[model samples]
Target chain A: MVGSALNQIEIRRLVKAFGNRAVLKGVDLTVAEGEFLTLVGPNGAGKTTLMNVISTLTKPTGGLVRVAGYDLADGAVAVRRQIGLVSHKTLLYDDLSAEQNLRFYARMYDVPNVEARIETVLRRVGLWGRQRDPVRTYSRGMQQRLAIARAMLHDPPILLLDEPDTGLDQHAAAMLTDLLHEVGATRRTVLMTTHNLDRGLELGDRVAILAGGRIAYQAAKSELDAEQFREVYYQYVKQRV
Target chain B: MPLIMPYLRKVFAIVAKDVVAELRTREMLSSMFVFSLLVILIFNFAFDLRAENQKTLAPGVLWVAIAFAGMLGLSRSFIMEKDRGSIEGLLLTPVDRSAIYLGKMLGNVLFISVVEIVILPIFVVLFNLSARDLPLLVGVMILGTIGFAGVGTLFSAMVIHTRAREVLLPILLFPVVIPVMLSAVKLTAAILDRLPFADVQNWFSLLVAFDAIFMALSFILFDYVMEE
Candidate 1:
């Protein structure tokens, strides 16, 4: 039983509500190590709420959450240390230079060799060239890249990205896809939420269709075609509405 | 040893960063200096004090200028952080939330101290008074600024997210910080008049007690304010 409980992320009976409206109603899911799990849902399906709960950014009304072998309720701080996040929000200081932003986070995380780590991450994210420029001077794509650099600075084992592709152009999106692929290849667990079905299908190891605050359908990339996935997705949305 | 060192270092780092930024921009200090000078100038005309009248009112006018200018500086402390999204960045880091609070408080204290340092000489020149009890006056300034910053940091964090942030900071802050201001003004007056320390022990005790209580409360409640 102990060996069987190897999932990197696990949720059981996760329920969240605001006022009388239940956002996530008795939802359950598990993500294994190195799994690239993409959650695709309509606007009000509670994907972000679930992500927030898992990240310990929001307290759930009810449920169990475990990340990186630590129970969220019991070891929230440890779990937070293990999970890195990239949200639609850039979360970068606009006035600080790119280098300062990374250095600030490195100090916060108490990462060793902070200067070297900052240099390496900046180079990896293709921001080393513009490390001295204030983030306010960065373009949207550049800012997102720096955000990714911040998230990856600590080398956390799990990454939760909420629409990491929000404002990127085609070239940037492709680059992001490549970066995600690189991250996945290194065996880090990733849980991402997006409305982009085609990219989600192409990048995800497993695509999950969330509707009515529950996962209506989940399939490996090889198991579902685009048309089948779309039909089922739309059907669930219509039924829920 | 008490896990306070790292937080203190963090606070110093933030203060240093803010000092450097301000030195480069002169945004906060210039505004505070100009505004404080204007307040003192207005007081000069309003009170219409001759040489003898200046001595009696100088302490009150000096502190009033410092307090108002300090509030202006504290109010803007988190505005830049929030506007630049730096607060969220700090929160997402694995550092203790209390460290962030202390760090911000220290930054505010440093800024207010700088303003006070500049204003002290100006006050002396304006009122034509000798800088008596230099060490004690400096001590009072530090304690007073700490108390003001402790309460101001907490209120600023609360109002940073509110719709009426600019208006809300003073509204929530003034009442809570009144005890510190009262104690500070008394102590400053006592020191300026060359009064005995024992005579002002009451104000000193009040200052120490207010500083301890508010600092502890601010440390504990900071986590809730920073929660996403």
Candidate 2:
């Protein structure tokens, strides 16, 4: 499940270290075009770091990372145009309305037909009614929905969600699950990092466990047994801990 | 024209976004304005600014107030982005990294200039100073602000992730920005004194040179500073 020739994202021997400490040590992973990959990892297991490197937010220390066939080294700007990220942080201006926030990002991404696209995304995330209200006034769930709207506003083919459900309540998380389902329905290549085993297994076509700064285990969802995989997840995570 | 238009548009987008955000919350401008006003008020009352010494004292006091208040605005410029994690949002875009720097620097200049515009007239009244050379003084201040905001914007991004960014920004910023302030103060004093432009031509050249140097340096270095 790791290697697919000519995939949308291909990471070979990916190394990411912070000075003396290494977070991701020679990670090898790939997500084919239109495939959803859920990377499950324990706390401090470099999930966000991997997402950051892929999104061109964090530069990798070593190894080849190619996104949408563009290398991270020389083609970061090109890669940025190909991916949209939804991190735990909302990444929004609280003072700006939802519409304004989208407009700002639309201009940044050079999105075509800005107003219409903003409306389309806002409607997709069910935030069109509150488009004019300040983001600071939004609940955690609403903010996450707006974040999804933001990520999709540019219509990038690849989506990277790094623990986007981190701060949401149960009801909001469920709503997020629904939103994720809708996003998955679009057949966009998505790489989501999650600690929620149930949601992780449910959403991804393939689920991979990240432990010891590497892909410890992985399998296609059709080939996985939920109970056995839960045992395997805890085993890998506990070993790292 | 084809290549530059998109770049300029992106830069304008960032500036426009900052303006909209600031207008909505009044977070950056109001604080900067009030703080600058207070600095002038404190100096005015403390020194008993009289017409005799006001000319000499005004340059240092004015620059000090503007620099300090500008620091507040500059610190908040990236801090706002970092606080909401919107800096990453900006970085994730395909726009050139230098465009982000320029936009942020321009936004800072605009905020600082607004603070200066409001405070200058009040400063003149408070110090019992003349308004004859006000335009020239404004020109000097704008040049100083471009330099100030240029270096300040770069340093603000450098310290955005630090635990003590609010404190660290001034420590890192003031030393680098001393030349800008010095030139500005010199020109301000020269203008108010109605000194021949030939006499102070050196300072004017120095101000313009530093503005160009700072902006160019910041623009070139911003990508490195922003990279993790």
Among the numbered candidates, top lDDT falls to 2
What proportion of the true contacts does each candidate reproduce? 0.38, 0.98
* Candidate 1 RMSD computed on C-alpha atoms after optimal superposition onto the true structure: 2.4
Residue B135, candidate 1: alpha-carbon lDDT = 75
Q: What are the clashing pairs of model 2?
A: none
lDDT string for model 1 (A1-241, tens) is 1112468899889898887999999888888888999899999899888888888877778888788888877676677788888988888767678887777677667688988999998898888889998888998888988888889999999999899999899988888888888887887899999999987888789988788988888889889988888888898889988
What range of 10 consecutive residues in model 1 chain B has the weakest lDDT sum? B1-10
Q: What CAPRI-style quality would you assign to candidate 2?
A: high
What does chain B score (TM) in every candidate? Answer: 0.93, 0.97
Model 1 residue B60 lDDT score: 79
